[model samples]
Target chain A: MDNHELFIQGSRVPDRGPDGDLMTLNMGPQHPSTHGVLRLELLTDGEEVASIRPHIGYLHRCFEKHCEKLTPPQIVPYTDRMDYLASMNNNLGFAVACERMLGLQVPEKVEYLRVVVAELNRIASHLVAIGTCGLDLGALTPYFFCFRDREMILDFFEEICGARLLYNYIWVGGLSHDFPEGMDDKILRFCDYFEARIDNELNPLLSFNKIFIGRNAGIGVVSAEQAWAFGLSGPSLRGSGVAFDLRRDDPYSIYDRFQWKVCVGEGLVGQLGDSWDRYWVKVLEMKESLSIIRQALAARPKDGDVREAVPGRVKLPVGELYCRTETPRGELGYYIVSGGGNLPERVKVRAPAFSNLCIIDEISRGALISDVVAILGSLDIVLGEIDR
Target chain B: MEFAELLGHIRAALPGAVLEEHPEAFSPWILVARAQLPALALLLRDDPALDFAQLMCLSGTHLPASASESDRLASIFHLFSPRHRHKLGVKVVLDSADPACPSVAGVWPTADWHEREAYDLLGIVYEGHPDLRRILCPDDWEGHPLRKDYVTPATYNGMPLD
Candidate 1:
C-alpha cells in the first residue's frame, strides 16, 4: 500500500485537480532538526501539510528486551542511552524503582546528591532543547551561547563521575561515587554564572527575539483537554496550562523539600500551548532548576557515606511496580515486573517523547510546512527515548 | 479515595468485570476479563468519581510455561487520574493460542502506538486497532521476540549469527 493508504486506510484520497500539485515528502531519517533518526512522511499540497506520518525505530536498540536480560544494577547504563541528555534523571528513576523493590533506605547524603545532579542535568537537557530549537528556526547564535553554558554543567558531571555523556553514577541503593573534593564549590559557582547568563544573555538573545517570537508564537496550539487526552506530560503538558508536575504532584524522593515554582504557559506572547509557550516554559524552567539546585546544595550533608547502601546483588521479591519521575522532556516511567529473580521479568519504559511524538500527526495537520520544524523543536523530543 | 474503594465502585458499576484483585502486590492490580475491558475503561475515564483520564502505560507480557492456565499471554494497562490523583492497573489474560483482546484505543487515543508496540513485540492482538503493524521491529520480521519461548534465528537475509 502507498503512504496515504497506509495512514488513512479506507478513506478516499483527495484529487489534485488538473495541476496535480500534491506531493509526499520525506523529512528525515538524517535531517539535523529531527534531533535523531526520525523520518516524517509529509503529504503536502504545495506548502501546506495535509497530513504527516512519523516513521521511527531507526535507533531502537531493544532497550526493554535488554533490561530483561541484565540485572537491576546493570541496567543503569542502558537507561542512560534512552534520553542521553537527561541521563542522571533516567538513572534516578530506575534507581528509585529498584530501591523501592529492594526496600533499601539510602543515606541522607545520597538524596541530596541525587537532587543536585538531577537538577543540573535538567538544566543541561534544556540547554540542548533551547539551543536546537533556535537552530531549527533561523536563529544560530543562541545555539552556540546555549552550548557554551551547557559545557560548564558537563564539566561538573565529568568531575563527579568519570563519564561526561552517559554516567552510570546512580546505582540501585546509592551512588557510584561521592562528590570529589571542592566539587561542591564548583557546582555552586557554575549555578551562579549559569543563572546570570540565562537571564541576561540567553533571554535577550533568543527567547525574546522578535523574529523568533513571530516564527514560533501562535503556531501549533494544543488545548489543555487535547494535551491531557493525548497523555502529554512535563513541559509539553504544562505548556498547555496543565499544572501537573511529577516532582510536585507525584512527590517522589526529596522534591517536596525544595521551593520551586511549576512554570505553566500563560500565552504571554501567543495562545496557550503554542510553540512559543512550550519554548518559554523551558526557559523559565531553567531558573526553577537553579533554585532547586541551590536548595539541594544548602541541604546537603557534609559527612555521610554515598555508597553505604549499595548492595552486592539486587534480588527483587516477587512483585511489580510502575515508578515515574519528571525528566526534562516529560514523565519517564519504568514499569518493572520482577519474578523474585535478579533479572527482571519485564521492564516496560513509558518514554515521554514516545507519547509526545505521537501527537505530531494530530497537530501538524493544516500547518504550513515551514512551521513543522518549529513545532517539532518546541516539543523537544530526543528520538533515543522515542525509539527505545 | 483508596484503591479498595475505587475497586468497589467499579464492581458496583460493572458486575463480574474484575476477576481478581491483588492488593498485596507491589503496585496493586486488578485482573479483568478480556470482554469487560472496554466497558471498565469507559467507566474508569468517564465516571467523575473514578476519573482515570490518563493511561500511563500499556505493556504486554508472556507468562512462563509452568503457569497452570492455558491463557498465558497478558496485557497490563496502568491508568492514572490527574483530577483525582489516583492510579489503577487493569490486566487481561489472553490465551496463547489466540492472543487477542478488545482494543482500548477508543477510550484512550494514547493507546494507539502503545497497543501497536505491544502487538509488535509480544504478538497480543488488539482486536480493533486501526493500524496494528509492527512498531520497533521490521514489518516482515518473523516471530515475536519478547515471548518466553522465542528463539533467535541463525540468520537474516545474508547475515549470519553464532
Candidate 2:
C-alpha cells in the first residue's frame, strides 16, 4: 500500500483498488464527544482504526505573543484562559513563576489560601474529567451527577472571586481578594458534602458499573515506558502506575505540608495503563483533593494580609525561572525570561495537555475506532491548554 | 545526584560541549552548542549517574532584533530525572540565518510536537524531525508569529484585521 496516500488521506486502503475497504473519517471540531474544538482524522479499516491524526489550533489565541506585550501582572488573566476548567491552578502557576523570578516571599496566609483554592479547583476539574469520560462512554447520568457537585465548587469560587469560569483571582504576589467572612466554613461544608456524595452516590453509579468497566477496561492501554517517552503527566501518567505527582515529587508551595495520598492506578478492572485505569485515577484523585482541602482548611492562617507583598508596580531584574505546578491535568510549567523590565521577555507555557495529546497517535494506532473515543476521553485534554 | 555534580559529570563526559554554565540563575542552565544537543541529550538520559529520563519542557526563544544573526534563536530543554529527583536545563543557541538543530524526537518522543511548535512559532528548523508541520498555527500561515520582528498581516484569507 502507498504510504504517501495514507499521509494525505489518512487511509490505508489502496486508491486504485476496488476491493479496498479502508475509509477516512473526521470526528470533531463540532462533535459533542470531543468536549471542545478538536478535530480527529481517523483512518479506519472497517471498525478498527489504522491511524489517527488530531488537528488542533481552532482555539489558538496567540497567548504567547500577547504575553510579550503585557506587563508581568497583566499576564495573570491570560493564564486563566488557557485551562479554563482549572483557572485557579493556571493563575497559581504564573503567579508563583513571577514571584520566584522577583524573589518575593508572599505571606503565609497567601500560600495556604492558594493551596485551598487550587485543590478546590483540582476537584472541580477532575469532576469534569470524570463526568465527561462517563458521558463519552454512553453513560449520561454520571455527567449530571458530576456537574451537580462541580457547580457547588463554582459557587464557592464565585463567592470568593466573583467569576465562575475564568477568574483572574490569583495575582502575581497574592490573591485578588481575601476569602469573605464565613467563606472557609462554606468550603468546609462543601468538602464534607462532596466527599460523601462521591463515595456514596457517584462511585456506584458510574465507576463501579459493570457496563462502564467493560467499555473502558483494557481499551487503549499505554505501557509505562511509552507513557514516559510521550511525556504523559497528571492522572494519565499515574494511571500507567508511574507513581509520579509533581505535587509530591516536586514539592511546590504548601503542598508538602498537606496530608494526602498520590493515587496511582492499581488496574482494578483492566491493565494498569488502560483507559479504565486512567479514568479511575481521576475518580480516586477527587477524594484525595477533598482530603487536601480539609487539611488546608483546618490549618489556614487566621489573619494576615494576603496582599502585603504585592507591589503596586511589579518589576523584575534580568533573570529566568522555570516553575512547574501540579494542575488538575498534570504538570503545568511556566518558563519566564525577564530582561530587567516590567514585562517578560518571553513566556512559554509547558502545557500538560499538549504533551498528553501528543500520545494519541501512538496509542490509538491499532485500537478500534470506538476505543479511540474511549482513549481520547481518558486523556482528558482541554483544547484551551493544548492550543495555547 | 545534585545538579552541580550532574553538570560536572556531563562536563567530564563531553569536553567543550558545555559552552557556559549559569549556576546562580533561578533555574540554573548550561548552554551547549546546537550540534552537540542530541548527543548530550542521549548522555543525559542514558547515563546512570545523570539519568535525566524525562524531557519536561522544550521552549524556543528568539533573541531581540538588535542581536546579530549568529545569536538569533535558542531552544531550551528542561529535563527531569525522576530516579534522582533532580532537574537540569539545557540550552542550545542557533544563528537565525540557518536556524536548524538536530532533532531529539528520536530520543524522546515528546520532543516531536515541541520541536514542531518551536519551528512553527520561531522559524527554527528541527533537522531530521519526522514531520515538521505547523502545530499551533495553520499549515498555510505566512510568517512565524513569535519571532521578534514578526509583523501581523492586516488580512488572513481576505479577512480584515486592523
Candidate 3:
C-alpha cells in the first residue's frame, strides 16, 4: 500500500499475504520503547507487521486482590501505584468512589485542591508521553526538554505533598494536608511558564517537525466507530474526533464549574484519528489543563479546612457503586461493592490503558516494524496500569 | 432518563429479561437473568433509544455463601451511551461452582480483554470467548485466587512465596 492510500484509509493489509513468508519477532519485556515491561508478539511479512499480540502482567501486583483486604481509606496508597505517572488523578478517582459509597462530600477548598493537583499531573504525564514518543521516533532533544518541565511540576508536587512519586495525599473523604504557604503563586508561575513553552519549545522541536510528522501522521489510524467500540477514552478516543470527556459529560468533581474546551483531533496536518492526531491531542490537552489550573486557583476558597469532614471511622452500606473519572490516560473506573462492612467485598478497576492497549492489534495490522514503535508510543500504555 | 424510566424502557423491550431492579442503591442497577445476557447486551447496544455505544467496564464479583443464597459469582457490565449520555449497570449472577456465561466479546470489542480478565481472576468461564487464557495470572496457576476460599500457594514453578 502506498503512503497516500494508507493516509486516507486506515491500515488494512492482509494478515498472511505476500506468499505466506512471515517471520515472528518478539518485541519486549524490557525494550526501551515498550514503556514498562509490556511484551509484543509481532507477525511480520518482510519489514511490515501483519499482526501483533500484546502480552502484559510483568508488573502485575494484583491490586484488586490487595484492595479486597484493605479498607476504603487504606486502598488509597495502592491506587497511586496503578498509574504512577498520574498518582494524584489515581488517588482522586478511588477517593471519589469511596466517598460516593459513604455519601460524603468535602469542603469546596478540597475540591479545588483536587482539581489543581490532578490538572498539574495531567500536564506532567502528557509531557512524558509526548517526549518519549519523540524519543522513540529518533528525536533526542525534545525528551530532555519535556523532562525538564516535568521536573518543575514534580517539585511543586513535593512542596505540597511530602512524597514526590506516590503522594497518597488525596484521602477517601478529603486531602491529607491543605495547601502550604505561598503554594498558589508557585503553581501559577509554573502554569504561566508552561503556556508559553508549548508553542515555542514543543511545537518546533517535535509537534511540527517534518520528520516527526512524517513518522506519526496517518500511521496508526483509528476510526470513530472502532475507537468507541474498543472502549478507547481520554486522548485516544478524542484523537478520533470523539468529543467525549467524562469531566464535561458526566460532570464529576468541580470540572463542570470550569470553562475549557475539549481538544479533538481535526486532521490539521494529517488524516483525522491517525497516530499524529493522537500525539497532537496530548499536546493540546496540556494547554487546556493549564487553563483549568488557573481557573481553579482563582475560584478556590482562601480559608477552609480541607480535612474538616474527613471520615473518622469506616462503615459501608450494603450496596455497590461504579464511579469513573477522566484520568490523564483515559477513563479510570472503580466498581466497588460493599457488604455492610469496613472492608470492601469487591474492587474492580477498569484501567484505561488495558482497553487502549487492546486496540493495538487492530490498528497495527498493516504497519511496518518501525511504525509499530510510533504506534505503541501513541497509545502510551503503562504496564503497571494495564496489568493491574 | 431517570433510573426508573430506563428500567421501564428495558422491561418493555425485553420482557422476562430483568430479574430485579435496585433504584434505591447508590448507583441504580438491574439484575439480568444469566441466559438472557447476550440478547440483552445486543439490545442495549443496537437500540437507538438505549444506544449504549460503549461497554465501560466488565467486572467479576464473587459473593460467598450467605444466609440468603449460596456462593454466587456475578459479572457486572457498566454501559455508557455517548449519544444519550446515560449510564446503566447490568449484572448477571452465576453459580460459583460452575460459573459460565456466554461471552459478549463479539458484540463489544472491549469485552475481549475484560472477559479474559474476569475469567482469569474469578474463574467465570465465558462460553464463547475467542481466547480465554489467563490474563494477569500465569496460565497454569492452580486455582482462582480471588475466591473467598482461596489459599495462596507456598511455591509456584519452584519459586517460594518468600
Fnat measured on candidate 3? 0.85
Best by TM-score: 3
lDDT for position A345 in model 1: 96
Backbone clash tally (model 3): 0
Q: Can you write out model 3's per-residue Cα lDDT over A1-388, one digit (the tens) per residue?
A: 2554554344444355658798999999889999989999998987778799888888889898998788878889999999999999999999888888788888899999999999999999999999999999999999999999999999988989888889999997789988889999999999899889998989998998877887888788999999999999999999999998989988788899999999999887778999999999999999999999999999999998888988897777889999999998999999989999889889999999999999999999878888899999999878889997
Give a tens-digit lDDT track for model 1, residues B80-130.
Answer: 999989998889998899998999988898999999999989999999988
Model 1, chain A: how large is the TM-score? Answer: 0.95
Q: Please tell me what DockQ candidate 1 reaches.
A: 0.81
Question: For candidate 1, lDDT tens digit of each residue in A274-329?
Answer: 99899999999999999998899888999988988899989988898988999999
Please write out the lDDT profile of model 3 over residues B94-160, one tens digit for every residue: 9997899989999999999999998988899999999998899977898888888889999999999
Q: Write the per-residue lDDT of candidate 2 for residues A1-388, one digit (tens) a residue.
A: 2333233245323343356477899999999888899999998777667788889899999999999999988888899999999999999998888888777888889999999999899999999999999899899999998999899999999999899999998898888899999998898888888889987988899988877777677778888888888889999999999999989988878888988889998888777899989998998898898888888888988898888888898887798888999898999999989899888889999999999999998888867777788898999999999998
In angstroms, give how far residue A276 of model 2 lies from its true place: 1.0
* TM-score of the first chain of model 2: 0.94
Which candidate should be chosen as best, given DockQ against the real structure? 3
- Model-by-model DockQ, in order: 0.81, 0.85, 0.87
lDDT of 2 by residue, B5-96 (tens): 97789989998899999989999899998878888989998999887778999999998756543448989999988888888999998888
- For candidate 3, chain B by itself scores a TM value of 0.97
Candidate 2 i-RMS: 0.8
Clash count, one per candidate = 0, 0, 0
